[model samples]
Target chain A: MSMFWIHFKKEMLEAARSYKWIWVPAVFLLLGVMQPVMMYYLPDILMMSGDIPPEAAALITVPPPEEILASTLSQFSTIGLLVLVLSAMNTVAGERSNGTAELVLPRISSVLPMMIAKWAAMMSLLILSFVLGYAGSAYYTSQLIGTLEWGPMLGAGAFYIAWLAWIVTLVLPLGAVLRGPAAAFIALGSAAALTMLASLLPSHLQWSPGRLSAIATECLTGGDPSAWAPAVSAVCFMALSTIAATLLLKRRPLLPQA
Target chain B: MMEPVLRIHNLTKHMGSLTPVKGISFNLERGSCTALLGPNGAGKTTTLRMLAGLLSPSQGEIRYGNSGETGADNQRWQKRIGYLPQYPKFYGWMSGLEYLIFSAKLSGLPGKQAKLRSLEVLEMVGLQEAANRRISGYSGGMKQRLGIAQALVHEPEMILLDEPVSALDPIGRREVMDLLDRLRGEVTILFSTHVLHDAEEVCDRMVLMVDGRIAEQGELSELRAKYRQPLLLLEVEPGEREADWLRSLPERHFIEEAEIRNRAARLVVQDMDEARAALVREMADAGIRFQRIEAGASSLEDMFMKVVGA
Candidate 1:
């Protein structure tokens, strides 16, 4: 426990010192603040260009207040997912490659602590990024659409956090078990592939936490988040993945002086 | 024996289908400085990593001995080991002090204690002045020193340095060697090196590993006494019959073997004093005019060559 905390605190310090938390959030915040503003003026910009054909104009029917909010949330969440996945993939594998991971394993309790500390620190960073991005989107949306009913918006916010948390958790084990940046890319690609497969099913299949970030934007606009029963089914998958990762990583020996 | 701080019995490690580390075993005693000398691809690094607990054996167990019976024993054992890898790459963006402190924490030291120990080890490895500088700015030697500092910050009972001075210049090698030497009698320092001089200067005892096995192991004096041979070189002019005459002197008493090179004969003798006198007598009796005869003590390189050859 002490060793785990020590590793965790050291990671936090490293993150702070490197200002890794700063850049990811700064970029996400910029995107977050711009999403609603862009959504508001895109129609005007299109009208001014006189390129709004009759068929295309049918798709632009002055998006409802709920749809506008959903669009803003999707804008922020999509980028949020990518950045979090990229960051998480490099977590343990990078340290392993750099030869510093072995220096500690021999001195510490077990590989478990190292994996846990890395997971915890990364999750903290992921949560921080999601919250900051969501908050920026919320603030920007209010300025454009004027007023947010704390209830529905908060529910949408909760779903976003849950979906992001689940994705980060799934990526944790892949990042922990594999070596190099390729593992991170593979995890992202797998998540994307899973989402595409899920989309082929009926609305009932679309509630997977992995699929929720994209679908929830529509759900927040009065589409049924409940219609997606796969979210509950995915609970089993995410839990199993987390457990398998822990077990495999616990036994995976640190690469010796090779 | 001081209870063998590290004990590896029949350790075998296989990577995929290739077995790089075979069934090799050795014990490390407390406060004894030993060197693992081997050529490249000889498994020196693999052996050190197994001892440090960084690598698990495919077969066999590494039982770390300490004063305990159960749950707390392994934990206690780990806190006493410091491992410095052959190529330790730090976060180049981090300052030297930041890296040390991070290592201290990872080694299970509390913040305040970690800070104090980091400072102490930085001074020990001569990185105190450069502690605040970015690791990227450090020269190769300085980076190695920082690695050493991080390895020692926890004040482990056993310090395993893998080729600690392999790439350093003469001065940096001396610095690392001096540090390891000073720690002698206080901590068991086992460092692997291909450089024979590093082993000669700092190690009290040594183990020569070849093809993942201990070829020879003991104090220098013991190995010298066992393998030392008095060799004499004779230089003769071109097309001289001196080489044939020297070979005809005999190989029983003083001459162990003889080899001819161009016009010169190289003799392997049993005793230096006896060989010189006998050679002179032989030359006088044979009336052979030789260019020059020179004799000298054998070196570690000679002993290493002989061992490897054997």
Candidate 2:
């Protein structure tokens, strides 16, 4: 148990020394504030671009505050997820590639605590960045567009975090088996495939982890949550990723072959 | 009646099509330092890694205790073992002190005790002054010392170091050797090295590996006595006639096995005095321009070459 905290503290210190805490939240802050501000200034910016006809500028209607927040999530789904994946891609892969695993592996009896520590540390960073971005987006939406129900906004944030959790979880296991960029690409690809499958067959894939994204957006729009399937799947998937990473790390050589 | 610290039997690792560390076996006696001696690609690293629990052997048994009950996947036994790779890498962002503390903590030292142990280990490895420096700024020798520090911080029953001094400069190698010399008997060490002199410097026993097999292994003096042979070394300038004459000298009846190089020959003679006298006479009669001739004995280096020569 103490070993878990020890590893976690070291990981946090690594994150600090690498300046992950600074840049990750900074990117999230930019992505978050850009949404509502851009929607509010869309007409003026479009008019200034001269190529747009007067009719087209008038045709553009600013979305509602709740919908604007949801669109911000879609932005996060793309570039924000990319940022998260790229940063985390090296977590396990670097340890193996750089030969740190050789020094560390023999000291511990089981890899479970180390894997759990890594997952928890990553989750802490993920939640921090997401919360900062969501809050920034919510604050901007309330100021520029309209008032929002704090309860629903927080609810939307939680569901969106759950969705992102499953995606980030992919990094741990993939990083164990593949190099950084390959692992990042595959995690992104898997998330895309699952999300697409969920959208294509919503009823059939109601319990799919990918449904967390839609559930997140629906939370903002006061959509119903009667099914309760996506939530369960998201938690299960997170657990599975943590377990898979530990097992893979155990099965394979700790340090990569020189 | 006491069991060895660790016993390996018929250990083999099949990495894809290539088999490194083929059916090799040796027992590590308690508190004994054994060198996993081998040349490059002779599987020293593979064997050490298996003992370190970093690589599982494809076919073998690693017995840890007197009962020999716990097999290869001895999860609980991992805490008792420490490993430092040939080139031990670190999280470059971490300070030396922080890395040691982390390693100590990972091996189950409590927080306060981990810090205390880390500091003690840093001083032990002569890195206390540079403990706060980030690892990225460390020299090769400092990093190697830190590697040893981390290995010792947890106070494991045994430590495995793979070519600990292989990548260092002369001074760095000497420093590590002296430190290992100081560290021997405190904890059992099984370091790999291709340099016989390095093994002879600190190791009490050695497992000489050749082509993934244990060519020879025992107490340093025992093996030295067992394979030690009175021999002859002859060197001649590389003229065609002199080279031909030196090669012909190995074919004499008294010569046992002859190892001929470009202009040199290392011969194991049945009778050193008779072989030397006859060879000198033959060279003088043939007018061979010999550079140097010495009648001596075999060292570990000679044995190493003979094991790998085939």
Give DockQ for candidates 1 onward, in order: 0.62, 0.78
TM, every model: 0.90, 0.92
Off by over 4 Å in 2: A47-58, A225-227, B1-3, B68-73, B233-251, B258-266, B273-293
Tens-digit per-residue lDDT, B120-168, candidate 1? 8888888889989989899999988888888888888888899999988
lDDT (C-alpha, whole model) for all candidates: 0.75, 0.87
Considering every candidate listed, which one attains the maximal TM-score? 2
Candidate 2, residue B104: the lDDT equals 85
Candidate 1 Cα deviation (angstroms), residue A31: 2.5
Clashing residue pairs in all predictions, respectively, total 1, 0
Best by lDDT: 2
What C-alpha lDDT, on a 0 to 100 scale, does residue B304 get in candidate 2?
Answer: 85
Predicted complex 1: CAPRI docking category? medium
**Ten residues in sequence with the least summed lDDT for candidate 1 chain A:** A249-258
Interface CA RMSD of each prediction in angstroms: 2.2, 1.3
